[model samples]
Target: MMRTLFDAELNKLNVDLTKMGHLVEVSIENMIDAFKHQDKTLAKEIMDNDRLINDMERAIESRSFNLILRQQPIASDLRNVTSALKIVTDLERIGDQAADIAEIILNFEGEHAYRTVEHIPTMAKKAKMMVHEAIDAFIKKDLSTAQMVIKMDDEIDSLFQEVKQEVTEILKENSERIDYCIDFLMIAKYLERVGDHAVNICEWLEFNQTGTMNDHRLI
Candidate 1:
């Protein structure tokens, strides 16, 4: 029956999307190390592996399109396909943000990290964990866990604000150190954005079940 075929295709899409999410999580992990050590080798590796994320995006996109076209899926099924497309966009953007951080890492000449870098690694780790949990929620279709990840984004944003406040003080005390401090701010911002993307993943996951929430507090 058509229903059986649709369900089979749907399961396969979850598998592919989960695989893509795992790669994005690892890329973010490597980026954290790349920033922490200011390792050009690690930074270069992040850049090199970006194409793999690109390829994964393409693969998931193809699968999503096939499902939509062949299944003529509507209601929750349509939402799933649409959600997969949105998830890919978020994942690709996460990859881009990670690469951008890596490019900045290369400029440090593998020097000691910028003054506020102690927090960047911590923030990256938190954001990466949120992404991991969000992906797990998607795989399990666990709305409660997805909601928890959404709540955690609040903490990540707060941490980002704390880092920014500290960096502002440093820049005021030593204006000459502004260049490196700006890099630190960017790392903080990217991790914050990563948290936001995780929220997006949660948002779409929920949309299929309870319909869309008008409030995007993650914004």
Candidate 2:
């Protein structure tokens, strides 16, 4: 009976963490959409939505730690709940990074977008997909999927580098557009950090699964 009760609590913790991740994922998607369209209204909406993710993050942290203390979970069970705690922090940080990107969009105010950025949305889409896959992998206990998501980080990084190079070239060719170039580049940097956080959550999930932290999980 005690074991069953412990399992139920752990399951509830996992559910809450995943729900928190989904909310962060939504913020990421909308932030990117707002950036792409230069939509101040949507950007404002994304900034306002950060509170929901923050509240869920705190709740998960409290619950996970409470379970750790009350249950004194065994090795594997300890890993599971502890990982939820760590991953929620990463998720909340990701939400903050996404919000930062939204704020950059807010700065544009119809003046910074020189033409159109074709790569930002694509990079955001891939990064946001990675966040979704990482959360799903944790909830489903699918180590294979988590590994795949970690590997995809390189692609997002590549896109970030590409954006940086393209923006630099544009600024060099046209000194008048330097401000717009800088804004766009800053936005890409935030997106790159978002992808890195996604990778961090994947690593946390893998560590929880194997109770090991070697690079063997890197696909």
The top-ranked prediction according to lDDT is: 1
In the order shown, the candidates' Cα RMSDs to the true structure are: 3.0, 2.7
- Give the alpha-carbon lDDT of every model: 0.83, 0.82
C-alpha TM-score for every candidate: 0.90, 0.91
Give lDDT tens digits, candidate 1, residues 66-181.
98888777677888888889888888888878888898888885347744545666788899899888888888889999989999998998898889888888888989988978
Query: Which tens-of-lDDT digit does each residue in 77-185 have in candidate 2?
Result: 8788877878888899889988888888888864536346667777888888888898888778788898898899999999998888888787778889877888788
Separately for all candidates shown, the number of backbone clashes (residues 3 or more apart, or on different chains) is 0, 0
Q: After superposition, how far is residue 111 of candidate 2 from its true place, in Å?
A: 5.1
The pairs that clash in candidate 2 are none
Looking at candidate 1, the ten consecutive residues that score lowest on lDDT are: 210-219
lDDT of 2 at 87: 89
